[model samples]
Target chain A: MILTVTLNTALDLTYRVPALTPHTTHRVTDVVERPGGKGLNVARVLAALGHETVVTGFAGGPTGEVLRALLTPLPVRDALVPTAGATRRTVAVADRATGDTTQFNEPGPHICPAEWAAFLDSYETLLGQADAVALCGSLPPGIHVGAYAELIRRSRAAGVPVLLDTSGEPLRRGIAARPDLIKPNADELAQLTGAREPLRATRDARRRGAHAVAASLGADGVLAATPDGTWQATPPAPVRGNPTGAGDSAVAGLLSGLVEDLPWPQRLARAVALATATVLAPAAGEFDAGAYEELLPRVQVATA
Target chain B: MILTVTLNTALDLTYRVPALTPHTTHRVTDVVERPGGKGLNVARVLAALGHETVVTGFAGGPTGEVLRALLTPLPVRDALVPTAGATRRTVAVADRATGDTTQFNEPGPHICPAEWAAFLDSYETLLGQADAVALCGSLPPGIHVGAYAELIRRSRAAGVPVLLDTSGEPLRRGIAARPDLIKPNADELAQLTGAREPLRATRDARRRGAHAVAASLGADGVLAATPDGTWQATPPAPVRGNPTGAGDSAVAGLLSGLVEDLPWPQRLARAVALATATVLAPAAGEFDAGAYEELLPRVQVATA
Candidate 1:
């Protein structure tokens, strides 16, 4: 089973309005709620792909309860530890007129030291049953900066392959622990390595201690710098839809490929296909099965 | 005991951000949650004013549970009926840079036929112990447009005075039910009576069937048209803060005065003072006790 950890889970709310205007009142035409966090999104996509995925993280308060309830119907197993503070919420207000989205992200709950210790205990237990683990999303307040590094090291100690999908300092520190893989988007890659060129940045990130680096370049697709060879996988055509969870879908694809022992080229192809299908899907974190199948063989995987 | 009915209850969330720009992402600096709906606001103020207030309405799902949990610590009693649909949430984004607010109101939960019937049963039972009832706010989906009118007629049948505070068709139909009192802000009054003139519209509203009409004129205060006489109650000075719950505070003031058997002039004075103090208060739905007392004697109630 694949294990995914979301330290800062969220109740994602999407509000559709006729139009968005600053300092004005609007009546939302529709509201959609989903269980969200990078790891949770990865687990959801993994489950949809017929993989046995277990998600562990901190969930608390009313928002946490709602998030857990939302996750119950999904195929992903819930092993989230409880926290004292309320989970945060992210509101994406979509303006129908302009097709633009305004996002408001609330800082997630603070994790107590005892809660951190409790999570580590559960992580160790879950790692024993896992072939691969993905540590994703931001570190909630009160959690130490090196939390991801510790988790990655623990995964290595257990001989389980781990993928680190986070940004900023967590990614910076976690990479040094030599996770099996690290996925960073263009912006995250730039922030981590201060390099504008995608190939150079991905290489720089690999040098920082990641075993391999897969840098997402949005519409340009996934650029993978692996030990086997460097390759750039591009979609057949640019997909037009929400790109919110496309990267998480890519993470799921890469982890699934690793567990199945697929070659780097095949893994990048699957990652690109999944990310493209996620963008083509109507909702975030979900892939169009037909689109994924259609795009799989069409994905152009060539040496970078 | 005063009874306040919020047919479409909400979990009001206030998000403070540095600034609001359309179609951009924002990191909310602060988040504040409160039980909201006009009647709930009135109940909160009444509870603060040392009155025994009971709030009943439809509350369900996770948002409803959170609203109820928030209401637990308050002095007011909770008799809200449960529904299968989740309660709505209203997000008020406060932009600190511009000192402006952008509001997004979610369409509340749909009250099914069975749920509406159950609420009616509860309302009738509660009316027996009530001195006065306030029917406030917009009706949720699936509820009849004449829901407030039916509640007002039932309140009258139970010999309980009812105050109607709503807009559009609900207000139009509810007025014909001859509620004991109806409070309309200038825009609502203009919408109902087609008169931009405050005093004319207030009197017109009374003639349309409200026994008394207290028209809120924003910073100018309230113009009251009652059976006994016509009076204009003005605040001692322009008090400015958040005007969000000012009208609900005014409703609480009038209802409390009615139960205490205060004269028309005194009731208007209290209403105006409370409304002013509510504006002076930092948060919505609360009046500063010190400001309320200081402004009470200073409020000018003169024959119109």
Candidate 2:
């Protein structure tokens, strides 16, 4: 089973309005909610792909209860610890007239010391049954900055392959623990390595301590720098749709590929296909399976 | 005991951000939530004023649970009926840079026939022990447009005075039921009576079957047309703050004064003072008790 961790889970709400005008009242025509967090999204896609996955993190209060209830029907196993503070909500207002979205992200709930300790125990137990682990998303309030690094170290101690997909300080520290793989988007890659070019940034990222680095360049495709060699996997064409969950889909593809022992190029192909298909999917962060299947063989992988 | 009915209750969420920009992401710096619906707001103020208040409405799902939990610490008694559908949420985004608020109001949960029948049973039981009933706010989906009219007629049959506060078709149909009192803001009055002149519109509203009409004229004060005569109540000066809950506070004052047997002029004065104090209060829709007391004696009421 694949294990994923989302420290700062959220109840994502999407509101559709006729139009968006500043300082005016809007009658939201529709509202859609989903259990959200980078790891949760990854686990969802993984489960859809017929993979056995388990998700662990912190969830609490009314919002947390709703998120858990939403996950009950999904195939992913829930191992979330209960916290005293309520989980946060992220509102995305979609304007029908302009076809644009305005996002308001609330900060995550504060994790108490006891909750963090409880999560650590749960993660260790889950890792024991996991073939590979993915640590995803931002660290919630009251959690130490080096949380991902500690988790990576623990995964390595247990002789399990781990993938780190996060940004900023957490990503920087976690990479030093030598995770099996790291996936960073173009922006996250630049922030980590201070390089403008994708290939250069991916190489610089690997030098910082990642065993391999896959830099997702949104539309352009994936740039992978690994111990074996460097390869660039490009989608056949760009797909038009919401790109909210594309990166998480790529992470899911990569983790599933790693566990399945697919070749480097084949894994890169799957990752690119899943990311592209997610963008084409009508719902936010969900992939179109038919599109994924069709795009898989079309993805071109060549030496960088 | 005073009974207030909120057919379409909500979990009102306020998010504070540095600024609001179209098609961009914002980090909400602060979040605050309260049980909301026009009737709920009125009940809150009435309870704060030491009135024996009972609030009945429909609440269900997770958001409803949260709203009920929030109502637990208040002095008011909860008589809300449960439904299968989840309660709606209204998000108010306050932009600090412009000090402006943008609102997104979600449509309320669809009340099934069984649920509406259950609510009727509950409302009838509560009305038997009530001195007055206030039917406030919009009708949720699946509820007939004449729901308020039916409720008003039932209140009359039970020998309980009923006050109606709503807008559009619901107000139009409810007025024909001859509620003891109706409170309409300037715009609502104009829409109902097709008269831009406040006094004329108020009189016209009374002719349409409301025994008494109190038209709130924003900063100017209130124009009242009752069986006794015509009267105008004006505040000393306009206080600047959030006006979101000012109307509900006015409703509370009017209802409390009615139960206490205050004279028409005194009730108008109390309503105007409470409305003004709510505007002066820092929190949305909550009145400052100190300001209410200070402004009460200063409110001027005279024969129109």
**Each prediction's TM-score versus the true structure:** 0.98, 0.98
Q: Model 2: how far is A70 from its true place, Å?
A: 0.9
RMSD of each: 1.4, 1.3
In candidate 2, how many Å is residue B206 off?
1.5
- Supply the global lDDT for candidate 1: 0.94
Worst 10 residues of 2 chain B by lDDT: B95-104
- Clash pairs detected, candidate 1: none
Q: How accurate locally is residue A232 in candidate 2, as Cα lDDT from 0 to 100?
A: 94
lDDT of 1 at B297: 99
DockQ of each: 0.90, 0.92
